[model samples]
Target: MNDYYGSVPLEEYEQILSNREYWDNISGEWEMCSKMEDKLVRLGTFVQRGGDLNRVIALYAGGREYTYRVTIQHCIERYLEALTNKRVDNLKLRLFKLEKEEAVKLLSEMLKVSIGVDFRYDKYTSRQVSFGVLDTRWLDAEGILTAIEQEHRQAHHDESVEEVRKRAHTWIGDSWW
Candidate 1:
C-alpha cells in the first residue's frame, strides 16, 4: 500500500500542459465568449452563431476588458463605420473616437426613433364600456369600430428602431474586437 500525493498521471499532465501552452500562446487579447447565438424572441432578431454579434453588443454595451464604454450608441452606419478601426481598452479612447458632430446626429437619431412613439402597443387604442341591464340595449357603435381597428396592435410591445438598433447589434458584429 502507498500514498501517492499530488500526483497527476503522465497523460493528464501532458494534456494540461498542452492546454496551458495553447491558451498562453494566443495572440493579442481574447475572450472565452465571442461569437454566440442569442435568441431575441421579443424582437424576432435571429443571431447566427460564430460571427460577431456578441462582440458588437458587448462593445456597444461597453465596459469590458477589450474596450471601454462607447458612451454614445446611436448612429448611422457611416458613423459607426468610422469606429471600425477604433479599438482601445480605455474609456477616453473610445469616447474620442465618437465625439464628432456626426456622432451627435447618431445620438439624436437613436433617441428619436424609440421615443415619441407610444410605449405601449396596446393593440387597442381606445376602450369604451357601455353596459345596461334594465335598458338592456347597449348602444355602442364607435366602441366596436375602435376595438376592430385596434385588433392589429399588440400589448406590452418591445421593439427596436430598426435602422439604428439593428445595425448596431447585427451589422457592427465584426468590429471593436
Candidate 2:
C-alpha cells in the first residue's frame, strides 16, 4: 500500500527529516541540560566521596545550586514542548511530568531545610539534609527510563504497520546498526 525508495519509503524520509529538524531546534538547550546533569552527578559523587562539606557549600553558594534548578526547569519545559508537539496523551507522560515537578519542589524544600540546620540557633532548629539526599531524589534515572518506555509503548500502539515500518527504516537509516 506504500511506495518505497531503496529500504525506506519517501514519506518516511520526510518524516525523519521533520523529526530531525525538531530535535535540532532544541538540541542546544538539551545539550546544556545534559552537561548540567553531568555536573550534578559529579557533585553528587564528590559529596559521596567525603569531600569537604564547607568547600562544597561554598561551591554551591557560588551559583551551582541556582544553575542546577534553572537547568532542570529548562529541561522540563523542553520535555513539555516535545510531548505537546507529538500529541502524546499518555498518563505515564503526565505522571512523569508531575514527578519532575515534585522533585524540583522537594529540592527547594530540602535546601530551605538545610539553611536552617547550617545556621542553627536556639530558635532555628531544623533537620539536616545531605547533598546526596537531594541528588538521589532529583536524578532518578530508572523512573525516567520507565516513563519513557511507557510513552513509547503508548505511541507504538497507535502506529499503523506502515508507520512502524517507516519508523524502523528511519531508525536503521539514522543508526550504524
Candidate 3:
C-alpha cells in the first residue's frame, strides 16, 4: 500500500537503509546531470522569453558536440510551449538534426567514457528521444510511499506505540490540529 511517502516492511528496515545508501550514490551522480539540465532549461527559457536566438545559439555553439544534452536543454528552455503543444519530442528531433552526424554517432562513445550508460534510441524513427537523465534514482511514487510506510512500520516495531506517538508530536511540537 502507498502513503504519501510509501511503506516499507518492518523486517526490511535494515535492507531499506542499505537500499537508501545505494540510491544515495546514484543520486550523487544524478545531481551533476540535474544541474546541467537546469542550466540548459534556463537558457531555453531565456530564448523563449524574447531573448535573441543568435546569442542563444552562440552561447551554445561550441557545445554542439554534446548534441543530445544541448537538445534536451533547449527543449526544456521552451518547456511550456513544447509540453502544451506536445512538441517536446519533435523539438528534440529538430535539435538532433542540427547536430553534426558524427557527434550524434559519438554519443554512445561519450556515454561509455563518462557515465558508463548507454544511449538508447533508433535514429531511423523521427520520434524525439526522451533524455533518460534522471535526478533521483527513485522516481516511483508508489514505491516511495511504500518505503515510507515500511519505515514507520519498522519504527513501530522497534518502539512502543506511545513512544512513536510522542516522537511524532515532538517533531511537530505546537501543531494547531
Candidate 4:
C-alpha cells in the first residue's frame, strides 16, 4: 500500500456528519450543556493553536459548525432560563435544528441584545480564511480567556441548577431578565 498520511477527505467529514448512529452514541455523554460549552472552548483553542482552518473545515465540518452553534445556543438557553425562570427547550430546539440562516439570525439577535456582541457571518468566514480565533469578535481575547476560565471553575464545582439560574439573573440584571 502506498503511504498516505494526510488529512481525512471532506467526504469522510460529510459521512460522519450524516451518520445518525455516530451522533446518537456521542449525544448521551453531552446531556449537560456545560459539556458542550467546554467542547466549544477546546475547539476554539484548537483553532487558536495554529490548527489549519481549511483543514479543520474539511476534516470536521460538523464539529466546527456544531461548536459555534451550540455555544451560542447554550448561552441563550441559560440566559432565557434565568430571565423567565422557565426552561426554554423550544428555543434550544430552534437553535440546534433550524436551517442555518434562521438559526444564525436568532443567535445574532440574542448575542447582540444580551451581551453587546456583534455576531457576523463575515467574521466567521474571515476566521476560517485566516485561521484566527473562531468568532473572537464576540469577545476580545482577554474576555474570552476570562470566560473560559470561569467556565472551567464552574464545571469542577457542582452547583445546583437553581443556583446557576440565580447567578445568571445577577449577571444580566433583572431589567434585562
Tell me, by lDDT, which candidate is best.
4
The candidate that wins on TM-score is: 4
Q: Which stretches of candidate 3 lie above 4 Å from their native place?
A: 1-31, 35-41, 48-50, 63-82, 85-177
Local error of candidate 2 at 37, Å?
9.5
> Pairs clashing in candidate 4?
none
How does each model score on lDDT?
0.26, 0.33, 0.31, 0.34
Task: State the lDDT of candidate 3 residue by residue for 1-177, as single tens digits.
Answer: 012111333223223222211112123443453344333233233322334333333333433344222342322224223223344343333323222222222221222222211244646875434332322222232343244445555654655656545534422222111
Stretches off by above 4 angstroms in model 1 are 1-63, 67-105, 119-177
User: How far out, in Å, is residue 22 in model 3?
Assistant: 28
Query: What is the C-alpha lDDT profile of model 2 across 1-177, one tens digit per residue?
Result: 111112344334333322212122234543543343333333233323333323333332343334332333333333332323332234233333333324333322323222211122234435433222222333434355456556656655665666545433432222111
lDDT of 1 by residue, 50-82 (tens): 122323333233433322222223222322222
TM-score for candidate 4, please give it: 0.23
TM-score of each: 0.17, 0.20, 0.20, 0.23
User: In candidate 2, which residue ranges exceed 4 Å CA deviation?
Assistant: 1-142, 175-177
Q: What's the CA RMSD of model 2 in angstroms?
A: 21.0
Model 4 residue 14 lDDT score? 36
Q: Give the Å shift of residue 170 in candidate 4.
A: 37
RMSD of each: 24.1, 21.0, 22.6, 16.9
The reply for model 4, stretches above 4 Å from the true place, is 1-26, 32-34, 60-177
